[model samples]
Target: MLSALLVTGLAACATQATAPAVPGDTALGPVLVDAKRMTLYTFDRDNAMPGKSVCNGPCATNWPPLVANAGDMAKGDWTIITRDDGSKQWAYKGKPLYGWVKDTKPGETTGDGFLNGAWHVAKP
Candidate 1:
């Protein structure tokens, strides 16, 4: 079965609309999207670390984490977690968010069910 993160009223992750870091209600259901309405995703592998992410280097190049700026802080449901590399990341209820490279346009969810179902479209 496909898993979903049911977050409502979006907790944290406010990069102030820079790069469009916000959840959006779209045709693909209640999934997160950036400013340009690009679909966002979450990797099940990152769940192994709870709110932290493991998709670094090449993995990151493919699925970029929904990053946080230097002063970004957790608010309501959103929280910031430091990666192994000491960089900060945005997490919703302890799950890190990401974007897929293959999604060439807004609302494209090509990464859903990717890697034998290790990746899924992030829900809100």
Candidate 2:
């Protein structure tokens, strides 16, 4: 019984570790983050109305999309988008979300208002 309990505890921990991070309030305002709490962003070029993503190829390399697992489900304002690569990505308010490669730490907003305002930090 003790060994079974231990195994169950370990399984719970593993599930928590792999769970995707949800949107939360930060100094930059309410924003979506990854499991590590790194800030997520959105591209102005992408249309939020139809939930379209235009960041691909080299653009995608610089700003990696916040991917969603097959098991992830849409909740409230958060939704999943299908990328051109056929992978799933996370979106907020119909706008596809991304993570800037240059942001190395949590709560960093270095990618905010970048590229002549084409890129901005995801806010709620």
Candidate 3:
């Protein structure tokens, strides 16, 4: 029964096309991606801001925002917001965190690019 429950729980997570990081909880460490969930998380204080994402257009296609759900709020340093498209996303320290689609693995920080050298790993 325990194994069945675990499998069911994991399956539910996997089916979420856009899974946001759970508020108040830091990922594995130093901004680790949950391969099972295909989500990114960062630990930092996020100032309330809406529809303002540093990554947009092509940038957004690469680093997808971890969408948030309604009733979500800042936990510790994390905050939630509704994007222009009415989609939910997580932000930290007033900056939205994203996951690089090219990052095919948990520890892959492939999003580190020149983009004026602004993109970086989401750190706690």
**Separate clash counts for every candidate:** 4, 0, 4
Q: Provide the RMSD of all predictions against the true structure, rounded to 1 decimal.
A: 11.1, 3.7, 6.9
Using TM-score, rank the candidates from best to worst.
1, 2, 3
lDDT tens readout by residue for model 2, 10-119: 88666544435566666778777887889889898897446878999999999998888766677777778898999998888788889999999888888998999889
**Stretch of 10 with least lDDT, candidate 2:** 13-22
**Residue 11 error for model 3, in Å?**
13
Off by over 4 Å in 1: 1-20, 25-27
For each candidate in the order shown, give its overall lDDT on alpha carbons: 0.76, 0.82, 0.57
Q: Give the higher-lDDT candidate: 1 or 2.
A: 2
Q: TM-score each candidate.
A: 0.78, 0.78, 0.59
Question: In candidate 3, what are the lDDT values of residues 9-75, reduced to their tens digit?
Answer: 8876555543344322233345634434343532222223343664556756867787666655566
lDDT comparing candidate 1 with the true structure = 0.76
Best by lDDT: 2
Candidate 3 Cα deviation (angstroms), residue 81: 2.2
